[model samples]
Target: MSLFAGMAMDEESVKAGKLQIANYKLGENVHLFGGAFYLCYQKGLINWLTDWNPDVLIMEANPRYIATPSAVKWMHARGRKVIGWGLGAPPSNSPHFLQKWGKRQRGVFLSQFDALISYSQRGADEYAALGFPREKIFVAHNSVAPAPTFQVSRPKFHEKPSIIFVGRLQARKRVNWLIRACAEMGSKPRLVIVGDGPEREKLELLANEIYPATEFVGAKHGAELTPYFAEADLFVLPGTGGLAVQEAMAHGLPVIVAKGDGTQDDLVRAGNGWQIPPEDYGALVQVTREALSDASRVGRMGEESLRIVTEEINIEKMVASFVRALNSLRY
Candidate 1:
């Protein structure tokens, strides 16, 4: 059976609900409808599920509120199997305690489903680490619509060859490391940030005082970020995994990401982008300087980055893998 489960997917940045709904429609072989705590404001989802009575209760990511056993109970009570779908990252390689906890929480929430969906091989391993049997795991990559063919022109900006960083401005994101790296850049490459967070005010001051070339463009979302992506010679994130790293790569911008499990680890490879070990400020600074000094190398890296996404990673692959996993469940 087929189903469409919704959740708080309208939030800015990354929203899983919209992605899930699209996947459900694409995989129309089974019944589809809202399930568990759908983000849709209309109440009585329980009644809605009870009424439609599909073969499965489908969802993306880790379930919230009615996670695992409770959600499993809810669906089973209605004579339907609960099929959890979405990416799950392993915590084995992470140094962050919070990341480990969050991973564990997702594992607990996902374990109750008849089967779990994973966007990448790394995500599938997270489930295995949680003691989930191979039969209970589904592995799939997310997918996206094909982008228009661009001649890959710069966004009509000056050729400053700036080092750009995007994503939320938070300590966990480790944006400060980029700022510190800029200070160490003896040639003084322009360091530009295209996001905002609680660390904004402090980061702004820190940039102005310590690294004069550093600039923060407040918060740019959706289309506003394209120009930066188009103009940047290299993108760096001193933090963990984020879909943005893939977004950067999609835009033909190579990323210098912190080494660890996340979306970045999947994108940054040997010759495409740099993945320095976590908290390696000196190495971060050195890599930034080296990449900035060679304009040709930087451009080639950007092209390679885009190639990585188009060739190996796309939202469509991710979504398809997830749907296949959901459909393979015995329950």
Candidate 2:
């Protein structure tokens, strides 16, 4: 498929093998209103659209993208189909009036699309709740590149199990909470923190003060990062983001992730791992202890983790969902 992006490939994303590089790039991405709104423009967009003339156009679901509305109008004029792809609608549980207004605006924007493809079932459900036709909404569970092989055997529980957290050290990640939770444990696991970010220094200081043995391995990707997942008995993401959880499962480690983006609902299930209440310290510690408490059970759970990634969700399934959504539409 021909793809376009607003940014060039970065060393980190390329090395991590996460993002698929675009065939062409648009103008520099502009963020307005303190980065809440995103807009990208390209003088060549119309030229590309005319030359390619795709039967279907799948655009970002975010209403804030300044070019999307015009693009949608362009496609509709040609009687071509358009699909809205995104994480989900605005937070359904948010009590803020602004969020409610945002959700309404999203609904109005998304109503223009011929079909919707969400990253998770939770997202699909949200779209339906927003009055999008349920039949038109498809779920493509978010994924990472699967491991070359699922050879990492289930880890045996030890006096101190190895717990790995892979992702940027950002405030929203809540790595500090992970440290505090481990510190309170009677038998703390060996915490290996992979990745570096703005919060790395503050996190390192917090780790030293409480969980002194926590390892900060800077950032490793591709082959360098695999060993960390292979060696760890468990993977924990205390804050938002679930991409690393998919990688951990592919390597046969049961995960413990806080309720983050709605994707967690699909990734962390009863069979594969635990999804603790977000920002709940007591829940994190309790779940970690229980997961590590049984060596054999952990192994079985790891196997389940592998099964989920292989049989249920991956890049292959994600692509298939896109194809299915396109096939279901009349173009």
The CA lDDT of each predicted structure is 0.67, 0.81
Q: Write the per-residue lDDT of candidate 1 for residues 1-331, one digit (tens) a residue.
A: 4343443332223334434332342221222345532432223445455566666776654443333354458788866777666666444445689667866776666667777776656777777887777777766555443432455654322356677888878777788888888887766667889887778888888877888778888878767888877767788988765557777777888678887644454657867888888877888888888887777777778778777777777766666665676667643
lDDT at 57, model 2: 90
Off by over 4 Å in 2: 8-22, 35-52, 91-104
- Candidate 2, 225-257: lDDT as tens digits: 888887789899998865778888888888898
Of the candidates shown, which would achieve the greatest TM-score relative to the real structure? 2
On lDDT, the candidate that comes out on top is 2
Q: What is the Cα-based TM-score of model 1? A: 0.72
If scored against the real structure, what TM-score would every candidate get? 0.72, 0.87
Model 2 RMSD in Å is 3.4
